[model samples]
Target: MTQPPAAGPTPPPGAGWSGADEIHDGLPAAPAEPGAGGRGLRRGLLVAGATAGVLVLGGTGYAVATYVSGGGNQPEEVLPADTLAVVKLDLDPAAGQKMAVSSLLDRFPSLTSGEDDDDLRSTLVTPLLADNEWGLTYEQDVEPWLGNRMAVAAVPDPGSEAGVAGVVVLAVTDEAAMTERLEAVPADSFAFAVRDDFVLLGEDQALVDRLAAGGSTLAEDAGYTEDVDALDGDQVAVAWADLAGLQDVVPLAEAGAGLGDQALSGRVVLGVHAEDDALEVTGLTRGTAPTTSTAATEPTGLAADLPADTVAALSVSGLGEALTTSWATLQESGIPPEFEEQIEALGLDLPADLGAVLGTDLAVAVTGDLAAPQFGARVRTDDPQRATEVIDRVAGDAELPVAVSPLDDGYVLASDPALADALAADGGLGDTEAFRAAVADPDDAGAIGFVDLGELIDEVVAQGGDDAAQAQEYAALGALGFSASTTDDGGRFVLRVTTR
Candidate 1:
């Protein structure tokens, strides 16, 4: 963190700050430039605002020590049941969680650059408040009142033009100090009310007052509770959005590139957790569009059958059925007629011919040295000859530099014919220790993705630069694995990075 230049004596509380009126009208406008410290303060606030925006769309940290001893209350317990979206960060986690976080941060030195302390106040908050014109140091102002947990939520606001208002919930250790801190800041956009150990901040007094009243909270909503409960492991941070409610706040059809109504009728929840050796992020959705195909419930085995030397691979089941189902859904949703004409112009049927080419199981793999890599696509087709004929027709006079050949049960398209022959001869990717350690429940997954990092790490080390040292940190990193499967209601996915 770059230190800002020294400034004159600190201004009196709420002294030189401007833009208080903007809080009532809309978002707080940038305060009038005061000195170097003031400029730093402005930059910090902007960055914080941008992070909040991302949380509202996608969905960190702490005042640590206070909550670790006696875990803080969950933010959802206090938020309104009608809240559209929420992002919460837990600073004080369990002992194992602390280690996982530290180990993960060690992998990337830049994030911890110029920092000597691990305490959140020292390493994070202090830097943001270091040279503010208000002369407010985290130690003197924030640390005294800040607690361990914080969250931001989007709630319905009939009075707002956007039809939604933002709410911030911060855990407080000292209500009096928290009150003084708020008064010291000239901004009035944040009308606040204290309830128990937490303070609710909103655009207006009515909103915070409503939260304080707290009749039916989000914790009582069955759908929200189910999604959060589905997440495995103890979470360090969590984000959730009600897709149906979000559509009203954000234009889902345009934003999601023509998503159907069914797609926007679900709830999405994302959780971050620290494992013994790896940090994991899990996502789950419920009550979304339904697919009748059961092929995704069974493993394809195409990936495991790839050559043992494969460095990266992706395998997906039920592509054919999924394609047909999606096309039918799109038609029902009223796709532009021109889109269908474009497909016809390409000399292909809507889904029949495409489905045949993709087959039920599809896997793509990369092998050999990085300088001379080989790529192969394997498709499990009932009629290999017909699939080959379609490939030839698609290639037509283009004279593509690839070969199509038959496997025991399917067809393989390879940039190198020898690679295809190798696949037919032998495959042991499933037997590799790295693969076994990385992938989980491969036999039941709908989709699987994997990458062996050993060779890639070596290649980076050979280059021998500043990055070489950083790459070395990943030496213990064996591979990365991803798996997705359909659930009774919707779908679930997990991503894991394993270390030897």
Candidate 2:
């Protein structure tokens, strides 16, 4: 396990109790008093928020070391169905996931350097217990009961105008020990209840009590279930948000103007999964605005036809039409006046002429030696002559460092005339082993991107410095690829980093 910096030494048994008692004794006499609601609730919420943050950090590290597969007790199973947001960490995962994380740690031993043992008590519980105002100690209070999974959730608070409350759910091995610790904490606002094998901590006693009773749960919500099920692999960590539910706490106007009506009506789910040679993050959004018919579709292998030596490349199709269709929306969304002036200065109409310049399919690539790399762009067009005229108009008076050449059905623009000629010829970037390994389904993606990490690292190494030394450590790390596509409900995105 990764051993982070020590938080500090643990206090002797009961040594910090005097200070905690003093602090608690200083509180307002009545729970309903004005000062109690203000100061006491704020203090309790701070502790709860800090505890949740620390546990998330600790849980993520623990999951990386001890994850396994199979259904287990999840926080959603107990949280209210109206939860606005939740972050969960699972320490136990499946056998395959364990091996994947273990292999990754092996490849990068620095990730766990300075660790004494793999025990969660040493890495997680110890830091939290040390020198806390609550007078808790790891060996005496927490270590005897800590369990493997934890989650922090934000739920609506019906009684408050803020409309939200924070809850920390911790799975415990011994309910008795967990209850003893909660009873000993010296804070008026602190409230806790043990439900089954988990402890629920919050600032609001009424809210905590209600949750302990457990009517409907987040796991039972149809939208939550569907989004969680949509994740691609066994997740080590997950985060979810109910956008519509959160509007009661924070207004949509605060997010920014021009958001569609249905934008906040949806939910967002993000998950992290470990793979044999990489760690993958997948994201899915549901009930957002639908993709317009003019939106880009699958690539037509434009980037794949770039030179095999390409260091980086990107390709997308139908962007011109999309730009044209969304122009009015963009204007309303606050496109700067200077930007429009710049477009007009290029001797082009606002959207139509600019759309003609972009054409139907567009691709950009970087190739040649790193020191003097070549840059090129290709735009597919049915009217090659008109596109050439637009390109010339945009590059007027040699203002831009580019030369344009006509292809059979498109135009190629490059920093060097030779590169423009080369981009017009047959190429084989798709056939390269690195390209194939990085991108999974380039042809089917609406947008595709690739980066030659190895080549970039080589350049850094050549530049020799502390950065070069650090770059050498990632020698085994190879290319990175990204792909995105519109789904029926929303969109799907995947990012992968390949390692040798």
Candidates' C-alpha lDDT? 0.68, 0.69
Best lDDT among the predictions, by candidate number: 2
Model 1: weakest 10-residue lDDT segment is 53-62
Q: Compose the digit string of candidate 2's lDDT tens values, residues 36-149.
A: 232233234323422332232233543457534555688888899889999987777666667776776565554455444365534655554445666556655666677777
Superposition error at 432 for model 2 (Å): 2.6
Q: Give every collision pair in model 1.
A: none
Each prediction's TM-score against the native?
0.75, 0.78
